[model samples]
Target: MTTTTPRLTGEYAIDPAHTRLGFVARHAMVTKVRGSFHEFEGTAHLDSEDPGNSRARVTIKAGSIDTGNQQRDQHLRTNDFLDVPNHPEITFESTRVRQVGTNEYHVTGDLTIKSTTRPVTIDFEYTGSAVDPYGNLRVGLEGSVAISRKDFGVNWNAALEGGGVLVSDRILLEFDISAIKQK
Candidate 1:
């Protein structure tokens, strides 16, 4: 017989300092570039009795995109890419959550980028839960989802001399989230 672990029910605010909002994209069709956003905020409300009742939301500052190279980062914020001047934020709001397996969940949400909104489903694993030294309750979750850049209106690309595009259309969004349960 298998025993089920009870879910932790509460409202939690994502800890930006301990959380990583990162992404991976193929560069030049031969290499992968990893980058992360430095500024973002998110919250999650979990329902212990009904996981499907859980909800989450997040907002990221498009200008905070950093891939180590200053020139490349700046280019990402321009009209050819993110167009941070016009679309300053990328947001996500969960519409549904379902348990797919032990410690795993499928979260469906609306992701908005640039001027487009698309539905995305991210698979998340409940890594763990614990009490911090500061006497705070915390939960950890890890998840990722792949999205098409063109679907979000980010259509800029360069052709390589030998053929193929400079960047891949697929982008992987990763989350390593640590959230503190509110009292």
Candidate 2:
């Protein structure tokens, strides 16, 4: 099968204010908890001619986790969890991208969280591109991936009387990214 060529263009930086790195997890096996990383940075190489050749890298400050509750956030940063003191950042570096369909691709990369590096693949969609009102060209991408929290060193949990656990292992990561092309 012939792959469509994409036009390689300028560098782009993620607009932190407009880009949100969020996650959701099942809470108590009946509810969902949503949260986001308040401090992070990312860069993208957008290629209009070869979509598969495009790339992205992201760095997230471990201490920037916020779930709207101070106590919960503190727990997440403890040694039993993210261990922000030891592993201060979570990062991702793309290794390859393969187009699955129009505007869709499988992005495989090495994701490091809390000192553990694992291979993760995110199903990503290119949501089209346009020139913004500020005269900056922007590209959009959205993706989601599910990961096991334990695999990343987050292994703390509390046993419940109902034979369940207080924390769920599965974490759903969602990315809504908007990047401005550098002139």
Q: What is residue 24's positional error in candidate 1, in angstroms?
A: 0.4
Best by lDDT: 1
lDDT of 2 by residue, 1-183 (tens): 013334226689999988889999877777888999989999988666666677889999989999898999999899988999999999999998888887788889999998899999999887867778888877778999999999988889888778878778999999999889888
Each model's C-alpha lDDT?
0.92, 0.86
lDDT of 1 at 58: 99
lDDT, candidate 1, 1-183, per-residue tens: 001335368899999999999999999999999999999999999876788888999999999999999999999999999999999999999999999888899999999999799999999998888889999988889999999999999999999999999989999999999999899
Off by over 4 Å in 2: 1-8
Best by TM-score: 1
Question: Model 1: how far is 178 from its true place, Å?
Answer: 0.3
